[model samples]
Target: MKPVSILFVCMGNICRSPLAEGIFTHITETAQQQHRFHVDSAGTGGWHAGNPPDPRSMEIAARHGIDISGQRARQVNTDDFERFDLILCMDEDNLARLSQSCPPDLQHKLHLFSQYAHGTTQSVPDPYYGGADGFLTVYNMLFTGCKSMLEKMGADDVAS
Candidate 1:
């Protein structure tokens, strides 16, 4: 089977989305299923393009043994819709923004990342301004969500 390509998106790509990317990447690698996936992250806006994930995001990820420091911000574009099997937005607003530009044929690929995140809220709250503790909270949520997303991909047998 072809590898699944997944894109994580948020408003700025500094905190939530990148953290999701890192958590998902860590999950796949930990399960030795990384070869079955292609992971990347971007934002709805380009204001933080080319910038690394927020420092607090980095700190929180490092605490969990996942490093997001290497992720640079970028804006979501039409190419993403075509390239990813799943283009998951961190929140409804970003999902709506992506919906406007995503090609009609590929619109089915867009989803709220938290949809796979059972027990968590329907959206992954952005933690950019909430403070350091917020990063920790967001991290746990994304960790659970990413694990669920992996299971949803039929990798449940190996997702533990």
Candidate 2:
């Protein structure tokens, strides 16, 4: 089967989304299912384009043994709607923005990242203006979402 493609999105791509991409990538790699997925991230806006993730985000990921420093910020584009099998946004704003811009036929591919999370949160909060602790909280949430997502997709059982 062709690899499943996923794109994680947030407001600036410097906080939540990049971490999501990194955490998800790390999880898939650990499960030995890297070949079955293609992962990336983008922002809804271009303000931080070409910048690396926020230092707080990178620091938190490093604590978790995941390196997200190499990921650069980029804005979501029309092509992203076509390129990814799933486009998961961080919060309601992102969901609405993507929904408005997404082609009707492709709308099904857009979703909130928290939808796969077993917890009650319906969205992932942005941690750009928050403290280092916020980044850690977001990381844990993304890890849960990514892990549940892989299992829901039936790709979590690959031999490590």
Candidate 3:
């Protein structure tokens, strides 16, 4: 089967999005199901384009044994609509913004990251303003959502 491609998107890509990418990739790899999917991240805004994820985010991820240090910020591209099996936005504004950039045929691929978390369809709160604890909080939520996403992919069984 072809690998499913997932793109995580946020406003800046310095914190939430890259963290999701790293965490999800780790989950897939550790489960020995890396071949099932490809993961990447981008931002809705271009202000931090080409910049690496923030230092604080790196530190927090490092504590969790997942490193997001290698991720660089970039704006979501037109081609991502075609390339990704899922383009998951961190919040509603980014979701709306991505929707405008997405073509009609590809619109169905866009989703809020929290949607896979059982009942919640709310936004993943931006952790840029608070201290490290906020990033950790966001990390746990993303981990939950990503784990759920992997389960939905039937990847849990594919590895066994």
Candidate 4:
């Protein structure tokens, strides 16, 4: 089967999206299903372009044995709408931003990352302003979402 390409998006590539990307990548690798997909992350805005993920993000991932410090921030672009099989946003605002910029016909590929979370939150709250505890909370949330996403995206990809 051809690998599915997935892009994780957020207001800034510094926090939630990168965490999701790292978590998803780690989950796939641990499952020995890394060959089944291509994963990346981007921001709706380019303010942090060319920069690495937030220090908090790197710290939290380090605690979990996932290395995400190498990933750099980039803004979502028109080409991404066509390149990725799926574009998942970290929250409602991120989804809205992607929806507006995404081409009309290809808008179907856009989605909320939290949909796979199965939690009380319909969105992954940004932890950029918080401390270590906030990062931990977001980490747990992404972990659950990423794990469920892998199971849902079997050989056939996303289900209806």
Each candidate's clash count: 0, 0, 0, 0
For residues 108-140, write the lDDT of model 2, one tens digit per residue: 999888874564547888888889878888988
Local distance difference test, per candidate?
Answer: 0.87, 0.89, 0.88, 0.87
Per-residue CA lDDT of candidate 4, range 60-135, in tens?
A: 9999899999999999989999999999888989898888877899988988887745544488889999898999
Q: Residues 1-160, candidate 3, lDDT per residue (tens digit)?
A: 8999999999999999999999888888888888888899999999999999988888888987888887899999898999999999999899999999799989999998897544577799999999988988998898888888888877764221
Off by over 4 Å in 3: 157-160
Considering every candidate listed, which one attains the maximal lDDT?
A: 2
Listed in order, each prediction's TM-score against the native is: 0.94, 0.94, 0.94, 0.93
Task: Sort the candidates on TM-score, descending order.
Answer: 3, 2, 1, 4
Which regions of candidate 1 fall more than 4 Å away from where they truly are? 119-121, 156-160
- Give the clash count for model 1: 0
In angstroms, how far off is 112's CA in candidate 3?
0.5
